[model samples]
Target: MDSSTTRTKMTVEEIVDALRDKIVVQELAPGVKLREIAVASEFGISRPRVREAFSILEERGLIERTHNQGAVVARQTAGQIEALFDVREVLEALAVRLATQNAPKGTWDVFRERFGPRAIKAIETNDMDYYVEAVNEFRRKTFQEANNEILSQSLDRLYDRTRVLIQRLVLMPGRAAAALEEHRQVIEAMIEGDAVRAEQLKRANIVSARRWFQDFKKFLL
Candidate 1:
């Protein structure tokens, strides 16, 4: 992303990576066509390679083929987001519950500290990098120690295309602080060895986030 990969000769995988980054960053907005020939010219690659890259991106649900348009950035729908969060809420809450009960002692101490008052201050100043990093790290450690194969696979696949959306959701007005506080409560419950309370708090957190998405659907959709 620091370098322009669009003007360079790229392999199909590289082209896919470049385009995916573009879509995630909203440089290629939803429903905007990505003509194969145009992309080939942009990347200084063959049309066939561009087509191959399109296929890969389509498989990842980043883009879709239309009647006349070769490929366009996929549009996100409210219904789709609801369904995703529905399943995610259950799976993630269960994961936290299991991890809290199973992880070795001191496993969540770092996250417990990370989600403290300092994170709220960062959110107040509109700095999300620190908060997002902490959330990602907390999730990584939770899933790592969750020790549930079914939950791990399900949750990983569910999260694949949600990175961008999650970032956007957290940036909503008053959302960053609310989410950090919600996460802090979950972490506190885990630290206290209260798996049931942690699970409930996590589920409530997901529900709160889903409501935020619904409230902002006009802007997002």
Candidate 2:
């Protein structure tokens, strides 16, 4: 395809999506260089568009630009990951608390019923993609129901950064099952209208999961 035609066909959003998927799936490993020219050529787009997409990814903490190195998939330090988890615990705790108090009647019932069984099936069948999608959907729906736009936006950004790490961690022995149970407890507390318990449980759950992920730091960074 001609350069101009390809450039016209591919929007900045499309470029961003492609790159984001690569990063999420670990096709572009942490700290791996992302060459602008190579990505532009691969996507059949101009360098400017690729740069724009990289800017978006950078803002989302999916990639970073280094002096003389262009863009690379972001590599979180141990300290950074710990700090990220700390912030996430607080934010997610607040989200669950608000969701419990403000949820429409029966709003969380659908998720409560579906999530555990889906997670068990994923584990039994060894279906990583479906498992990740199911968990992501549950979290997304919870944040949506919370009706706190600022908190949702913050969590969304953090989720983007931690997505790959979470996927890797969930595949570890016992982590998936543990995560399922944690989700169940959080949902149950929410159902019982115990906002304080729900928030504390949510925070503890995230912190525990973060520890599990930290155990795989050798594989990650």
Which candidate gets the maximum TM-score versus the true structure? 2
Model 1: how far is 9 from its true place, Å?
Answer: 12
State the displacement of the C-alpha of residue 211, model 2, in Å, after optimal TM-score superposition.
2.6
Which 10 residues in a row give candidate 1 its minimum summed lDDT?
1-10
Give the Cα-based TM-score of candidate 1 against the true structure.
0.79
How much lDDT does each candidate structure score? Answer: 0.84, 0.85
| Model 2: pairs clashing at backbone N, Cα or C within 3 Å | none
**What is the Å distance of residue 129 in model 2 from its true position?**
4.5
**Which of the numbered candidates is closest to the native, going by highest lDDT?**
2
Native-vs-model 1 lDDT?
A: 0.84
For model 1, the stretches where C-alpha displacement exceeds 4 angstroms are: 1-18, 38-52, 147-157
Q: Taking the tens digit of each residue's C-alpha lDDT, what string does model 1 give over 117-168?
A: 7888889888899899899889988898899888897786567556678988
